[model samples]
Target: MTLTLAIVGRPNVGKSTLFNRLVGKRLALVDDQPGVTRDLREGEARLGDLRFTVIDTAGLEEATDESLEGRMRKLTERAVDMADVCLFIVDARTGLAPADRVFAEILRRRASHVILAANKAEGAAADAGVIEAWELGLGEPLRISAEHGEGMTDLYAALMPFADAAEAKTAETAPVTDVAVDEDGEAPALPGNDKPLQVAVVGRPNAGKSTLINKILGEDRLLTGPEAGITRDAISLQIDWAGTPMRIFDTAGMRKKAKVQEKLEKMSVSDGLRAVKFAEVVVVLLDAAIPFEQQDLRIADLAEREGRAVVVAINKWDLEDEKSVKLKALREAFEHLLPQLRGAPLVTVSAKTGRGLDRLQAAILKAHDVWNRRVSTARLNRWLTGMVEAHPPPAPQGKRIKLRYMTQAKTRPPGFVVMCSHPEKMPESYNRYLVNGLREAFDMPGTPIRLTLRSQSDKNPYKGRKKPGPSKLRKHLK
Candidate 1:
């Protein structure tokens, strides 16, 4: 509950500018133009060692009921609701406007804590408008110029109490001690551990998802029941297994919307989606009794679509009759059902007995390591050359598809861009072939491999250059 301070105002009142000043970075898009910032942006703010969550909201404006701006206004209202304190800003140079009055009324009703700020108050010219801000009945206005960086000390002093209060609240709510021992049974060191690698455990209801996490932690921290949809919010636990730090997120059993009833359940679905977005690795849990169902496939496909490193965990493996046969059948079904996540780590585990927790942890860490692995440009080009040599690109329209150069653009799903003579004309089959080759070469079999083809003809400098630019001394200077 770090105090969330939202900087909100009408268009072109220097809200984003003030945000950049407070956050000490140009995170929000800043321009003289009005309504340049449409989305609500969040950043960590620090003023003299005091920390708080700062939010930059969209410019509030008058809107008709059916207009696009009206929808944007609704979004802004939601941002206001999320904030603990609202920094209501007004333009000190332009004086108070009707829109500012409207926003003041909104904040008066909504915000528990409000700080009235008169921005652009650097000189005597803005003095009149700074006084005008008091007419809104929201106490003394903070006179400051966000662009010129004036009057920040006063702002910091005003925000100190809220920051301290939030810190106290956080200390009260956080668990006293939530640490899991390593395999060697030593008290795990706290606070200085590795950054939490977000891992989402998602599956249908009654898939032993919570039980699996409890086994890993060696405690009954998460509630375990046979009932579906027991866990509403996506609860997260910071766990250390074998010296590796991981943030395990236990998501609710996501069901089809048609079957969902309560509003809380809908929010639970949204929570699951949020967890997926936050996660770097997603472990799609499956019941050994009913493996590779349509819902299970959907969950795994969603992880692949999100470009997350995926591992399929078949839970309750200890209870399965003909365990070896079931495991083999499930593996075949997994490969056949979701080819997009081919070779994904499918490990059997008993959440009740902790049969395969070690294997699960190992697979998760391996997937995470591979997800962050970046292939060198030289290695990528060599792999591409070998791929091309093994099976040449298809000839379409009697022209050989010329793939000139290939380079990895980014990792974390291992995206590569192939600069080619004709990108659109390159066959889809060829793209799939190259993707498979990349997976095999890079040892990134299960993760999604992105292969993009860019037509390099226009990118060649020779095509865009004029024969000669004005100066004859240009060549001599070179």
Candidate 2:
């Protein structure tokens, strides 16, 4: 088992910078703004020869109630309890505050192993604050600059004993690998091939994306309040749901581009877009009372354009007065307004009560399976023959347009290419016909499909013969 380390501190103490440095990548968002990270993010950290799982938690606040800040503090405390070693960081520029001391007391009682570090200890200006950090009664404070990469050797020395202990315990408890005396030698123990699927949940502000994830986790794993835009960073978590392993990303609420004026919020929106590109299935959560807003349609359309399988989820279903009537209306609006996603699954779920989650899971699995569905070349050609025979291509300017053959070039939002004559003259209406026919005949619904038309004359016909020099050209001309 790998050792786990948690970085805890008050707001704006460079905890995330240190996490990015240790992990050698900026996986967690870092900003001059305080309380930017509201969730616990875990990454594999490497310091010298030591390897461990490091968690970057939210800035520790004094509130312990149901407010947003209070919920953030509770989530940080949960990280402190789960980590094997707690690295308590303090700002060296601005001496120890009262909140830092309070957090020190909390970590002292909760965490098994604690290492005190004074960040921003690069110049003489931070000397006094480094000295003040020792007054918290957590032993000597290692003066280090997480931004400048100073004093890492001392931090490594402080954590070596814990790493050693964890390795020793793991050796004693871990099962030995089976060995074969034959030539194969049991093939050793390779890594497991069952990696988790990637999924992203996105929607407008206050759409209850975080609440839905918390319900799935069976705990308050994400920070959620009655405020709009509570989540900022795209936080990903690995979990096993209904016997399938998946890595689900809970993205920040995306409002209109006009409303996104702040630089921080712009960065947050960009991060959410990146998550959508990397995800296999994107769930567009919409409030039941205000379903099919303009921004909601835009978000879902963006997913389809990116060639990702989409699942439209209507949240806050428990607040509805007439369930059947509202559901019928929603289906009608979905089909009429967003014809591009005609067959996408529209599921109603109550994040507050966890109702209809099983249906949501089923929809997700079905969408993913369809997204990866493949069609054989022979079958695709047969379907193409029937489609072309049913509705023949148009004759533009007395020129016949014949589609010769069709074959699927790829899966995962299946892409197909067709060999056809007079490809440029093929109208968009005819292309749509073939695309819709493919979706119906191949049983692939809602997932984006790419259709390409190519003519045999489309290829370049360049000659490799060299050009004659000036004298030879003159003789040939004469």
Candidate 3:
């Protein structure tokens, strides 16, 4: 157990900038806009020789009700309570405001260890603001610039005492028992399987991605409400999801490109896309009322294009009035709208009531398995032989495109390469036939399959050479 530092302050006070400085990565999205960060995102931070866990919290607002701002404030307070130390930041450029004092008072009462810091105090213009931060009554403000990496040594000096105490406490505590355990609760993970699977939940705004994850966690680990796009960061949480060790990333609601005009929203969407690229499996949560909207279709296609295993989950199923008709309609729409994910699992779940989660979990596991499914070359060639015999490749200009051989090149969204004559001339329809046939024959439905065509003549020794002149051939023989 290491020390935890929570960075808290009002909106646009550079808390996220300081967090990125400490973590040495742009894990948290930062922008000029206020309240860009809405969730408590944690990262492993390193400053000087010290290493600790750092949490970047939402901007504190003067609200305690169930509104978005109020919920954000509560979430920040939770971070302050759990953290070993709280670093309260104030905007030096703007000077101290009433909200700063208000939050400072809350920190003084709640946080056992609080470090007062005035961020963006880099220039002479901020000197007055730095002096003003002392009026918050926490202590003398440490002047630091999170963006330019100024005054980090002072911040490090202030945190050393708490780090020492946390180290002593960790040495006395019992060891953690969060190891991998099967249903029997004794088996260990296989070699090369130490890390949990990476899964990302993504969809349109207000699709209940955060709610669905909270239901899966059985806790309010993520902030959720009636507001759309409440989540702004792609927050990753590790959990033993139904005996499967997995790291689930809850991404910000992604809107269509034209409507995503704000710079902050663009960064948030980019962060979500990066999560999709890193994930092994993606769960596209859809609203039951509008299961396959155009944006939803695009998101699903994006996941497929990234070669990630996808499971379509229709959230809020409890509100639906016609289950049978709706399910049938959804299934039909799913197939018709997204032909690439034709056989992918479409499970209905109510994130509000935690219904159909068991089925969702089963679907996720099944999709992951299919994504990693591999077929032996012998079996694949055998299947290819039959596929070709049934419907031979088209001959354009009397040139029969013979698929001479086929082999599985990789798994985890299966990829294959076919050695054939006139591979470039191979029509898209024939490639689709092979891809579909491989999916059905190898039980790899719904997962993206990569099929590459290459002419076998490229491997021939004489293929690329001009017909050697007779004299050149004689010289070579000599």
The residue pairs found clashing in candidate 1 are none
Ranking by TM-score: 2, 3, 1
CA-lDDT, candidates in order = 0.84, 0.92, 0.92
| Candidate 3 lDDT (Cα, 0 to 1) | 0.92
Q: How are the candidates ranked when ordered by lDDT, highest leading?
A: 2, 3, 1
Cα lDDT of model 2 overall?
0.92
* Candidate 2 C-alpha lDDT tens digits along 340-407: 88888999999999999999999999999999999999999998898889899999999889888988
Q: What local lDDT does model 3 show for residue 205?
A: 94
* lDDT string, candidate 1, 295-340, tens digits: 8988899999999999999988888879888878887898899988
- Candidate 2 stretches with Cα past 4 Å from truth are 175-194, 458-478
Candidate 3 residue lDDT tens string, 1-478:
8999999999999999999989999899888878888989999999999999999999999999988888888889999989999999999989989988888889989998999999989889999999998898888899999999999999999999999999999888958776777889886757424688889999999999999999999988899999898888999988887788888999999998999998888888999999999999999999998778889999999999999999999999999998999999999998899999989999999999999999999999999999998888999889989999999999999989878888888988899999988988888988898889988888888999999998787466877777889999999999
Residue-pair clashes per prediction, in order, are: 0, 0, 0
